[model samples]
Target: MEPSKSEDIYKETKTAKVDDSHEFNEAEVKRLSNYLSTRVIEIVVGVSHKRTFYIHEGLLCYASEKFKIQLRGYFKEAQTGKIPDCQEDPELFAVFADFLYHDGWLRKRKSLYYSCEWVMVSRCYAMGERLGSKVFQRECLWKLQHSITLKKFTIANDALCRILKATTELPERTTGNEDPLRALVLRYAAGQISTLRKDPAFKELLDEHPELGCQILMRVTDDESDCQPSGAPPEKRFEDKVEFL
Candidate 1:
């Protein structure tokens, strides 16, 4: 990424004062300005043909501790001003950048482009997990929760496959009992269990990856009290209260 004149806009320090009551303080403005600036480190991602994203060192260091160590620590990337050969999909990395800059673009895009947005969020979450950025993971999980809770988002078949594969392939984390991304995906599938099961591609995917089937079954089993099969008759719960005076 080439340097642009806009780089000057982000030179403000954290203590820079606000000009107006409605305007943001220097920190917020500087962050946004830095996101827009072309003069900064270039992290080239992807294979065969590479794609570059221009990001400020300060913004990276501030938002991600991994980036802080990699860029400012004794790592070679710190001196080279380049983060090359990132293993994440270029498209997913782009989405990750948007998450960092636009501050979780998923919320805005979720309703407008449901399936695609969910896919991006899932991919971004996987990328975040791989990159060791809890901030990104939390943001992605937050979007997933909102989307699932609202029950309005659609997830693409290929996206689901990607997510499933990503989760299943992820090495077990010593810090937690289960992968959060897997749990989130299972919960999401449980929300629309019938629709997902009915999809031929989904069925084939489950067949190919029995681990996913196990996850779906586990999700259904765990939430069995709350999630009833579509055709099952509704069971009403009656509560009788007896108060002793």
Candidate 2:
């Protein structure tokens, strides 16, 4: 096959034809090839009848740690202007595939790019909780575009809100940004802070105050308390309350 044809084949195999994400740096092309191998091997084993659904605990940890380093390094370096042209880079999506193809943590193929898209927008959604924020963003976009055409404001809104939040023309961590709630979300998503919900300064937010508490979530699981109804009675628990008896 001609070199051009091979390149076309490679691009097609990745489902990577979004005009926005077609520019490939050589370093990135190599990086994605390796990650795709990881995804393919794990998937083949998953489909094999001979294989039990047990995780390779040791390998899992090793992979997770390695991927974290790669993931963080990729983005951290981006802070220095080395960032990939996110909306147009297939490599950005590969970085996300590293997390979503986890042997167990993920089961949905629909929004394979959801986490990446989410991460790209705000960085406050879950950070690396369920999946890395960037990974979640891409998955959402990919799934939404593939599955339906219902305007998907919720999906687009989610990505829009975060990305808009994450982008600060000039950022100030002390005062929070002018758009503090969005800033808060970025910090949480970037893993700079633990949880947006629990930040002490969150109590200080005057405008979008309620949203601060809503974003608090556990680090390990990324589980959070956002769905509590607005008019629902305040939770009645007696954890550390003082008794007036």
TM-scores for all candidates: the values are 0.66, 0.21
Give the per-residue lDDT digits (tens) of candidate 2, residues 33-142. Answer: 33333211221111113222222222222233322332233333213322222222233334444444342222233332464554443342222222223334333333
Q: Candidate 1's residue-wise lDDT over 1-245, tens digit each?
A: 23222122222212333223323345454435534452378887777667888887655665555565566555577778888755457887777676566544554424424566666677777667556667677666666665555556477666666667656655567986777667777766766677777878778777777777776777775652222222311121112344369
User: How displaced is residue 188 in candidate 1, in Å?
Assistant: 2.8
Q: List the residue pairs that clash in candidate 1.
A: none
Q: CA shift at 160, candidate 1, in angstroms?
A: 3.6
Q: Where does model 1 exceed 4 Å of error? A: 1-39, 102-104, 107-113, 154-159, 224-245
- TM-score for candidate 1: 0.66
Largest TM-score belongs to which candidate?
Answer: 1
